[model samples]
Target: MAKEQTAEKGITSRAEDFAAWYNDVVLKAELADYSPVRGCMVIRPRGYRIWELMQRALDDLFKETGHENAYFPLFIPQSFLAREAEHVEGFSPQLAVVTHGGGKELEEPLVVRPTSETIIYAMLSKWIQSYRDLPVLLNQWANVVRWEMRTRLFLRTTEFLWQEGHTAHATAEEAEAEARTILGVYRRFMEEWMAMPVLTGQKTDAEKFAGAVRTYSCEALMQDNRALQAGTSHFLGQNFARAFGVQFQTAQGDMDYVWSTSWGVSTRLIGGLVMTHGDDVGLVCPPRLAPLQVVVVPIWKSDTDSGSVLEAARRVEDALRAGGIRVNVDDRESMTPGAKYYYWELRGVPVRLEVGPRDVAQGQVVLARRTGGKVPVPVASVLESVKAALEEIQAELLRAARERREANSLRHVNRDQLTEYMEAGGGFAYGGFCGSPECEVEIKERTKATIRVLPDPEFRSDPPPASCAWCGKKAVTEAVWARAY
Candidate 1:
């Protein structure tokens, strides 16, 4: 019995197999389930609730930054995409076209949205006829379809939900500023709310968003030491506006194409959350983003004990909820207190309150943390105790993740050392790039590690390398390289 329990605790331990452990946490925790459709999964209620919290927080940030919510069509005319040559070419392989609708063939095929840039700009062109109409900041909460050859639940799917912000400005400088503003928003949300640290920087041209003059990204290092692209901000630089005829009369009375920007973070962030904090047992959700931050379990052996324990449990739940916490009370008669502990811990509830006959009689309840701490607290002070524990847990998760990333990261790495590190299971490496596509391609073909970014000024190394790490050519910039999802 002891050995069996130990096996359960160690099943698919991340040290032995990270991929299996991730799937175990996601499926067994009831976050999501396999779906009937290929390359897609059904996000269960618990999973969706977490996403809802994320949406509410991110939506709040968008609104604070002068963005208004709007709706756009999910289907686009095939000709609309063709207006932008690079956009059409980049997404052609993943395009899902519908030739027949309402049981008849349509005159022209309609393409499900892989992204909204083209369609959104097509509309923006008609709306923005003057400088006053410029700087249109709009966002949409919607589902997008991109026929990915491979999918991993919330990470990548045939269909996924996200908020895409599209903005148009009268000048390139204004549009660029908007893109950077969004980049900061994504970074702040991930680090402050999700308790995940990220490196922000400009993506290499080879990896930048299709049709974007430049793309900025937030790169998070997961527990497995691989990088995840958590979010992106793109500067369109009049590409879409020109292609869609979105021109505005300048304040000086001249007509010119509007500069544009698009930025988004999607359900893939859920996957990033799972990878950043989950442990061998299961998920380790941060308190701020957890769907249920606290769970109260009442222990009773008889009908007499049940009444008192239940009453105390409800009291604790109400107190915590009133204290501005997302909480729930679990009072299932069929399950044991031990079983309830395991279930809630696996689901990553940040804190658990155990109300038993003795604890209730003493006017106290046991406080348990998902990160593995337990103490008895008087009912009078349970709310304060829980709030402190939750705050500590949220901070600790971020600290531990950042420490792990730094420990594995190697700065000023040479080509050989980087290749060896990647083959031995990689982490981030600071190196130099020659700014040549051939150089980037050669390194990827050799090491399977791409440059995650030319890190922003804050993250850039002091006294940057004088030569490229691979070919020893004159270095144009310092880059962060890692094997990524």
Candidate 2:
């Protein structure tokens, strides 16, 4: 049957062709697919479930940090986006405009938001009246639209799901602190849950968000050695407040523009996860982020003994589920045990338990980890073993990713050496930048490398480079430069 071959067909090898491998894995794994709409994608149930887990985890963090969830209009008045000059110019080219409404020409065209900073600030102005309302923390989980000429499934789609956090504060210091705080949260989430190591630092002026006074990000290196900006937190200072008339009366009877910040992480994170830990076999999800932490596939010598094995598998599943594990029992009669193993492995289930007639008789089950290890545990200890294996797998994934990042990363001292190395194949290259836009532009033009992040001393693993890598000028700071996604 055609269904049987779905698991038989293998994905493209990541080493031979990484991009093709990514697309093949995404389609073969049923995570996502192209849509009729240009540059858009349909997130299948498999993919959407991963996103749901991401949403729940992030929402908990946002709430614990005093941010409340809210909704805003999907359509923004064209004039509203034009309120901030830099913001408007930055997003204008990507804006999808709507002119007709209700079978009639609208009086004013609307822009499907590229980002919600402009429109959200418009509402904030009315909500905050005095210093008592200075810090207004809000977050929204929503889909946003941006017209794109080129697109990839979860990486660069025209329409994508994301959570945008917007906050308003009374002073520059408070706003800056809020941005950094969220940046730290993003770093923690990416490292702990996703098990992807990241370099947290500031973006160069050329790389910062439009109209932001400063932008900080957690830049992660993919398995292919390219950089992915997994998350960003931007400090808007007084720009959005001034443009949108968001001001609160001070306790001293004076009115001043509110300081603002905005930060977001999108489905692009799904892409990062795929690239960061995936291999030639398929996706290898960390236990913490995996939708199905454990899958029990019952094996049997014959259909005569299948019921017994299935029963054992069910008992194992029930025990894991009771212990707070997301477990699935593969009891399909149509598939072989090998097919089931291939199916769950391709889908990146973290731990797989195989309960066969012999194992059931012996009161043991074979434990196979997605991270490439196997063991046998007594049936009585299945729950405890699964718990321990999941924890061990989670830690190992983070450690392995960190080791790979360090291995692929390179250190360079000058432009020539960096360009030569990048021309061959690009990775994270630590070096010094002169902090000149010209120098940055030249490197991008020649080697296609951008400053991924300017690392803080504590985050930098090596001694600082003495001079600019792109220009032989005095170095402003040590930077991790790479060709990015």
Candidate 3:
């Protein structure tokens, strides 16, 4: 009986097998399922709801920052990609070409977009003619295909849903500002709503987005102490504009190319949330972004007790709903109270309320928190308690993640020290870099760790080390290195 319950309700120990545990939690919680397609997965209703919440929050942020949502074609002409030399070479391996459509071969081949820069820029070139159209701030929530050889559920897949923001500006400074602004938006969204801690900085040239003059990214440390690139914002700096001849008449009446930028965060964030906050039991979703905030579970001894207990549960649920809480009453007759607790816990519902005949008689109910611990609250005070509990849980999760990141992060003065740290169960290593692509490549080959970020002041110190941590050459910047997902 114990073994069966463990098998049915528990996942593989995270310490023993983190990958197996994550796959089990994702499947058993009904968040998603493997699809018939070789490297695709179906987002079940439960998983989609979480994504919907994320979309609503992020969309509102984008709109508030003066970005309007729009749509673009999913297919692009092969010639457009060719116009941008580095962009085409960067995406060549992942390009999925469509040579035939409508049951006939076409004269020109179309490529499913890995990213929309080429096509979007072509349209921008047609739409802009003067300084009046200086900045075109647009975003699109759509699906993209990259033809990935290896895939994970939400982290890396052949096809996935995401939002990409592309903007055109009159000056390089304005374009750089737009990219950083979006980076701030992404950092706040990930840290505040998702309750995840991240390091924000510039990516090294070798690791930056292809065709971008500079790329900025947010890197989050997971429970397993590996890094995840949560989101990125790229400063295109007239590269795409020049490729597509997006020349705009300036205020001074001169014809010059416009500066451009693109930034995006995808469904992979869902996977980051899981790995950052989840445990051996299952996912541990932060309250502000959880699909369902509160679940009401009723406990009854007999049919007689069921009548009163369920009535009380409904009253509690109605009260919670009236208090502006997302609530659901689990009244399944076939499942026991323990079973319901396990079910809701596995799904990472922030709070669970259990009402029984005794609680109803006493005018109180039992509250269990997914983060851990239980308390009892009177009917009159349940709302306040629930709200307080959720806020506390959200803050606690962020605090815990921050502490874990700090604890695991290390500062090394040389390559030998970096190697020792990597061999001893790596976290993030902060060191000085010479800013040479060849040096980064050699380091990756030796340690399997690449520069994750050239961290901000908060994560980096003043006056970088005197020489490169790896080569003892002139140090250009401080960088955080890690083995990533």
Candidate 4:
């Protein structure tokens, strides 16, 4: 992370106001800033580096799953969007259409990409002519415009960056498997790399993607006890394939429309990272994803000692770098060592090594873990000690977040309890849903809460509830409800 930015003197305590506190952390840490255009943000160097790390991890996962990387056009012909009725209807409200180009009105308007599904399918139809081309696994990283009315910097924005994966398969089973597999990949990354635990499940009919047969997601709870839909994978059973004529010959030599799937995770995750682990002081970035994992701060009392301390600091930095850690040495003349600690903590550097005249003389330095701890380690052993501390911090964050989510959650909640909890306090509530959109809508209307997911086996209530949580009717299935971001 960049080391020169100054953090604001005060942060709104999360208890004072979580929304305000979030904004304070993002701006004060120099993660992002407001741009000239409304509803847009300029990702600063530190923020972009975090996003870059996230992109690389996800890209590698996609490739390992046998998916290819490709690019699609940003502008789609207006007629292309209408090829799929449900898709067009769902996106119509947010579409940004371009009617004039080169200072003259084009014969037909073009739509800025809200997603690449429609355009990708149109090209797939042209490319696939036989059974051998049964599975076209591809993903593209690109920017999308959704024209959000009210936007939050990384959570919701008018235009944002993301990776969208599109694949075509000969059978519905293959497509369904692909969708589920992607969701698993997302879950693994969230827990292993980001150190954020998540629940996986299928979204209700009312909440599934525009033209999807089914949609699955990874939902994570923020520190404030609100749910965040972190990522989604959709199974499209010949919906887009039929609309765009993406057909292939079968082994029997018959032509049939192909089943398809699409999934994606985006920049919104950066916001989730902040909420998941950040403290009142500043961001507490997960070590695996942090751009600068270790920041070495050199201390001194006099000019004579300053030179030796800085030399020790540089040597420590080189050793850590050689050990494959992202490290930075701060030896600026103006800022005191104490100021450097505050600055790095705000930026979420996972570990800090403090070197001083005394420590250098003793051939040791004070090794500090950002999560909270300090120990003295001999100069010769700095690399190994720092690596172990980083791993411990990563595991500790995930463990703490999982415990918090469980502590605040409830099961078998009734209508009265649901209403009271949502109004007075908020957390995940598991109960039965009647499998009716009308019933779900009524609950939302009254409580401003929605079903997060019909959770997977590990998260479901043991011996599920017998009646609907809201209507008191016979239960159809269990669902997790929460006020979400």
Candidate 5:
């Protein structure tokens, strides 16, 4: 049996040691744990359950939008990756190569896919023959490896699981429209389902995907005042189609290359959940995605008296489960009720119910919300009360996150204000740029912040405005600068 440690104080008391606290919560909450490998983790049953719920929600959304699931090879030929120039340069540093197979060295090395664009497009060429065969929409859920210099569990691991969607369209306009449609799906999933708000915008030239003509992302601000790119959708604009010779016959009897798009959201979102809503007490999971929304613990003075308390607890659990809520009754005799509370709170369970002799006599159960303190709910109205409480907690978390983002974001016209903003907890800093690479470079050197995104349609600076932040020339467009993750 595993040795039990003494119940520690709540997480709020140790907010200064966030990193250590996070590690503790992950293990204690039974979410995930370190594996034998250096930078890999084993997602325990509890963690996998949460991921399964997320996958089900997303898969349903994808299918509703006319996408089908498919699988691709885990290994891609080295030559395939080199087909796209910009893509090769961007992902080369992260590729894990395989040089030997069947116990012998091979002539051509294979690379574990960092992203599946190369292989997916290679097949797309053969599959697309005419305009009738265009608009191929496919998605795959699988594990990917990206050799990393630093690893942090789900946030930046060497290997992680995610879903990547790739599509082809007959026309450039159609492809662009598909990209935006998927971006909307992602925004909806993150905000409505995950209960985390985001900033949706286009990526700057320097920040776009390696081979994409344009990239759109949903960015969320973490509690640390840093930005996390939650998901991305890219418009390939015939780059992959041209490289792989994917062509379709037009109505006019002319052959033309197909336009492509790809978008993805990875397990890194779990990290966003931990950072955005998590308090000093531990993880604060949004109700929609929480695996076990309500846990009921029965308290008794002795094993003989446990029968009555257990009956009351079970009755309450049945009522909650009937209301379409995920509920669990903790009837373990090995630990005290206080210890169980600590465990579930660390795991971010939204609500907890305690039914004991005294509470049963009063026809009520002691309810404790993870976000707020304890309250009492009548047994008769427990179902409605829990439903309302969970919704309230979800809203409170989103509001708090939005407030932090607003407080940290800054707009500046000069260097002095920019520096002041950075020192006072950095966030999105807006300033004018002349659309020159030279000015972009100067800004990065002066402040460690780069242009994260440029306004679409390119907002030009009006006359009589301040010069560029770096070049001291007439500015072109206002840009958002920040130190990104």
Candidate 6:
């Protein structure tokens, strides 16, 4: 027992040290590690596996919506980025430029893509010649570089992998519809698959993407009571098409520029998952995204009973695997069963099965849930039990997260109240806004919170009741403000 305690001793208590607990889990869980380069991280196999599951689920959703995958160059020409004024101005501060190559200085510097809108739209200009090519739905899975002053692993790294979907439509309405549709996909992915609750809405004009007419996002409340913009969809509204000269001939003997949209979800979401569901012990991955949903461990007191325990564990593993569950059996002889428990728990496997000599003798297995605690299950019904338990754990996590969100959220009219709440670690604060950049700036300066999103038009059955939170004038919209990651 003393030896076992030593192996698990280093993880910091969550309440005592939240930041250290997070870093410990990220490193001890074998998910990610600090890289030699500052502001960069190396995602290990366990972390990459979670990302792979996410990619597979999201790819299916994209394909279902008439989107196709494609690749773009890693570097975008300086001239291409300059084509869009707002985009260039917004991204200039974070741009990583390559001034030299092949031991010589280049005439025009190339930028590592902070985002792919510029480069992709430039190609769309050439591919779209006629109205027949009106709607080009393409997405790319790639890595982008953004020079951040401070970084945190998957949450704010200098370089991270993501998928960006860029689409061209014949009309503004179609483009806007596509943006909302993708936003729905993101909401569903976060709520149903990842078991994370999110608030879906539009960004304020001041907070919208640089070149977008409107931007939609799904924001999730972290355990720390701060909001994370999990994903965003932007309605370009001909901005990029006009900049890139992506015009197509119309059927009525005329020509018009295409309307475009771009949306993305990045590795930052992995961080959201950690902060939202993880506890003091380690990560508590949702069943749908857990790379190994169940792990079977065989416990034995002596070498004489090892063969029987191993056989029984393998049988249980095969049963789970046959049920379409990702299962692994840990049969390493050198490590004790207690050590194996700590190892898999740190890795965030959602469920674990213990098949010891006693359990095998009784024709049963002991089940342990990573999200909570232990449950004893019979071998005959082990498959069904595991399945039901996984579903329950997933639902419970979402429900718990939703409750935390509700508890932390605040709706206020007074500016003093807003500032006080934010200073005390606020969640989502909803208030009336005048839709002025100055008002937005004032709020940001007073309280380190920005306008996260505005309530959807369809949800606004009631009008704004009072003046703007920052300015004393008739409010135009109700917006959510929060300290964001």
> How many pairs of residues in model 1 come into backbone collision?
0
lDDT by residue (36-155, candidate 2, tens digit) is 988999998888888888898899999989999999999999999888888888889999999999999989999998889988999998999999987999999999999888998899
Task: Quote each prediction's TM-score.
Answer: 0.97, 0.97, 0.97, 0.98, 0.92, 0.95
Report, for all candidates in order, the number of backbone clashes.
0, 0, 0, 0, 1, 0
After superposition, the stretches of candidate 4 with alpha carbons farther than 4 Å from their true spots are: 1-8
Per-residue lDDT, model 1, residue 129, is 97
Please write out the lDDT profile of model 3 over residues 1-485, one tens digit for every residue. 12222365588778877777778778877888999998889999888888999999999999999999999999999899899888988999998899999999988999998999999999999999997997899999999999898999998989999999999999999999999999999999999999999999999888899889999999999888789999999999999999999999988889999999999999999999988899877888899888899999999999999999999999889998999899999999999999888888889899999999899999999999998899889988899999999999999999999999989988855889888777777889998998888889998999888899999877786555777889989888898998899
Worst 10-residue stretch by lDDT in candidate 1?
Answer: 1-10
**Which segments of model 5 are wrong by more than 4 Å?**
1-18, 302-304, 455-474
Q: What is the lDDT of residue 222 in candidate 2?
A: 90
lDDT of 4: 0.92
The residue pairs that clash in candidate 3, if any, are none
Q: Evaluate model 6: give its TM-score.
A: 0.95
Of candidate 6, the 10-residue stretch with the lowest lDDT total is 1-10
Clashing pairs in 6: none
Model 1 stretches astray by more than 4 angstroms:
1-11
Candidate that scores best on lDDT: 4
* Of 3 and 5, the candidate ranking higher by TM-score: 3
lDDT of 1: 0.91
